[model samples]
Target: MENKLMMRLVIATEAILFISLMITYVYFDLSVGFTKQSINYLDIKSTGIFSVLLFSSSFTLVQAEKNYSEGKIKKLKIWLFATIVLGSVFLFGQAKEYFKLLNNHFNISLDVFSTNFFTLTGFHAFHVIIGLILLIIVFILTLAGDFDRPNSTALSSIGMYWHFVDIVWILVFTLVYVLPYLLK
Candidate 1:
């Protein structure tokens, strides 16, 4: 019970941070207005694909948790691995996008829009990294026979964090990627 409560508190705090970052992003973006130079190289289609990949990971994670509860250890491991792969792919996509932006001279140092963009996404990425680490630790513990029906508290906590990360990404994607196009 305490574990669950603490996890919820942590997620709630993280949510506030993300909400603030998003508000700042929108405020700056609207203030500056969308210029061709501001978002010229943003590949919405590619980002959409990446978003799909990340969202699907959440589905896989849910399956993993369900499998664990059902005592299907092998299936749980497989689903957990799938979640990790999907998350890593999403991170790779983010890195690729960042490289492209930097190559095009769009960087955090450039303007308020760029700064907020990077800070928000970068913070989210950091959370993803933390999730990945948690997933990996849980995976190792499972492999060592440390997790069972009665020993799944840590796994459940990590699952909550993973789902939280996915939810935050959806919000960020909508605000940063989709909203700008619609607003324009």
Candidate 2:
């Protein structure tokens, strides 16, 4: 019971953090004097790809949790491995997009709009990286036979975090990719 409460608290804290960041991002974006010329260099298509990959990762993670609950160790590991691979791919795609933007001089220091854009999306990327690391740790534990128990709270907690991270990325994708184009 206490563990469940603690998990809920952790989720609440994460929710607060995400909400604060979103508010800051929106405030900065609206206050900035961004002409279409300033942000024309952004590669929205690449970001869309990364967003899709990250979202798909959450589905894979859910399958992994289901396998874990069913005591299918090998299947759980495979799904977890796939989730990690997809997450890595998403990170790589984000890195490539960032490099392209940098080459085009759309860096964080360029202007207020660019700064806010990079800060928001960059933070989301950072979270994704952290989630990947956590997933790797969990994967290692699974290999060590540490998560063989049915109804493992640890596995469920990890799944919750993974799902939350993906949801956050969805919101970030909407704000960074969709909103900018629509507003312009």
The prediction achieving the highest TM-score against the true structure is: 1
Model 2 misplacement above 4 A: 1-4
RMSD of 1: 1.3
Over 1-184, each residue of candidate 1 has an lDDT whose tens digit, in order, gives 7788899999999999998998888787778764656665677888889889999999999899889888999999999999999999999989999999999999988877788788998999999999999898888887888776645577788889999999999999888888776766
Q: CA shift at 40, candidate 2, in angstroms?
A: 1.6
Candidate 1 residue pairs that clash: none
Q: For each candidate, how many residue pairs have backbone atoms clashing (under 3 Å)?
A: 0, 0
- TM-scores vs. true structure, each candidate: 0.95, 0.91
Worst 10 residues of 1 by lDDT: 32-41
RMSD of each: 1.3, 1.7
Q: For candidate 2, lDDT tens digit of each residue in 118-146?
A: 77778778878878888899899989988
Error of 1 at 91 (Å): 0.4
